[model samples]
Target: MTTAQAKTFITLFLAMLLTSCMVADSTPDNQWRIVDEGAYAADVSADAQLSVVSGINNGIHVWRFGEAQPLFQWSHQSEGGDQSNNLVANVHISADSLFAVTADREAFAIWSLTSGEPIGFWRIDESSIRDVAVSDNGRGVLVGRSNGKVMFFEPESGRRIEFLGHQERINSVDITPNGRYALTGGNDYVAYLWNTDSGQVIHTFTHPSRVTLVALDDEGRYAFTADSQQKSQIWNVQTGEPISQLQYIARQKIFTDAVFSKDGKYLLTGAPSRRLYLWEVATGKQVGEWKVAPRENMSPPSAVVYGVGFIDDKHVLSVSSSGLAELWSMP
Candidate 1:
């Protein structure tokens, strides 16, 4: 071949190779870019802004999309005292406000999103708090403890109201959009629906496995639960009946968490094998799947996830054991 022709051929071949590499890496394995790293992120929520609570620093960090650095950070130590060792179980942002619970076993705090100043703090029971959910009206917050006790507090007044019933450590709690009902799950392999006004258990549903996570639909008609025994179930909020259940994909093994779309038409689950599954609510059909690659310093098997939240109808934010948090856009 002529020299000029040989040179052109090599250039074309290299270009194709590079394009192929880009396509391969562009798959689910690399689609998620790290939003935060180095700290053990416990909970994440988004409203007008994105918020993350890190157990390592016992701090709440806020990020506005398009900004290179966090807009601000609020830490437990800022409230005065040595709370560095406390683990933050959850962090939430609502109507420009932020709330977080410290792992010190009894305290929860509120903050102002705009100013990053501590607004108020309260102490619940002596048991470690496992989960927290803020009411839709932004007036109340529910705190779930390791002893299966749930406390409702008026954020402004710091008044505490107790709800009793579950016999094991409460793992998850979610309130309805109208602030009338709440669903809580725990180690007892059951979920209880409570009337917010009366603080009474109105209904209960049992699962074959430990219910690790729970989420209420935007309309308050349905409650979704993810269990450790490899399944996710949707319950009719009023009837206390499970209307549908999705078995875990056999190869994946562990089902970490589940969340419903804002419209309640779809459900999403995160698996231990670094896979995310999307299911149709009515038909119980698997609609989509995406895989997440383990971070560099993290081992695959031990990188189990415990948190998943919808960024919108078409995207989700997930956190893994390696403290890597990323946002995934859905298909």
Candidate 2:
């Protein structure tokens, strides 16, 4: 082939293989791009402004979309005294990227995303916290616990609201952008949504087995739930009616985390199967699947992913039990 023709053909192939938006039954494996490391992330989340990761490093870290390094990090470990090695279980960054909240084994804390300074901290009970969610403006924080209680903390006025969220330990939780509605999933075979102000259960969505994760779209109009039996369902928040039920392309897998895209067009799922799956929220159709490359020297067959989220419509972040944290984007 002519030199110019060869160059043109190579460029087209590279574009097709490198971008995350490649429309296929499965996204291109060549799209893999390891953007960050060092922390074994337990949960990863983002909004338009910032991306956050948390895990066994006993802290949460934040970064802008294209930056190679995190702007700041917060740790649960003591600086000097007892050297308590605490693990951060979950974290969420608000949509505005103004603040972030985290849940450790014993306490929940909020931090200023711009300054990297903590805004507030609270201790609810002896049981470790399981998950946390923050509002877009950073004033409201929802902290879920292993004891089945959901604690709402208002950092500005120092107010707290406690709700009996579930009969079993809470596993996942999320809040709407306006901070008016929140969703929780627990060891119980159910998911619950509550009016944050009145502290009342507005809807109860039951499953065949324990609910492992729950999430809401940016507008708070749609909710997603994944249960232990490998079923994932989407519902209309306003009506509490079933919208779409997503089935795994393969055998049943234990879902660890799930989230909707910023615009609510797509859904993401993480499982111990070492695979990440994306679906169309409107049709419940599988659009993409990316498996974490097997770790070096590890004999296990799967990567055991614990968390998955969209940094935006074009990028994806993942955290695994094997200490793998990475980012992939549409080239």
Which candidate wins on TM-score? 2
lDDT of each: 0.65, 0.72
Compute the lDDT for candidate 2: 0.72
RMSD of 1: 9.4
Q: Tens digits of per-residue lDDT for model 2 on 1-331? A: 9999999999998797666444232233222222233334455545533556664434566655456566887675433523353566566778666878776677767788778887766666657788888988897898888888888878888788888868989888888877888899899888999988988999999998888888888767689988877678999999999888896544455777777786778888877767788888888888777776554466754466666767666878776655555565633
lDDT, candidate 1, residue 178? Answer: 54
- Residue pairs in candidate 2 whose N, alpha carbon or C atoms collide under 3 angstroms: 19-331, 20-330
Report the Cα lDDT for residue 128, model 1.
80
The TM-score of predicted model 2 comes to: 0.80
Worst 10 residues of 1 by lDDT: 23-32
Clash totals, every prediction: 0, 2
Clashing pairs in 1: none
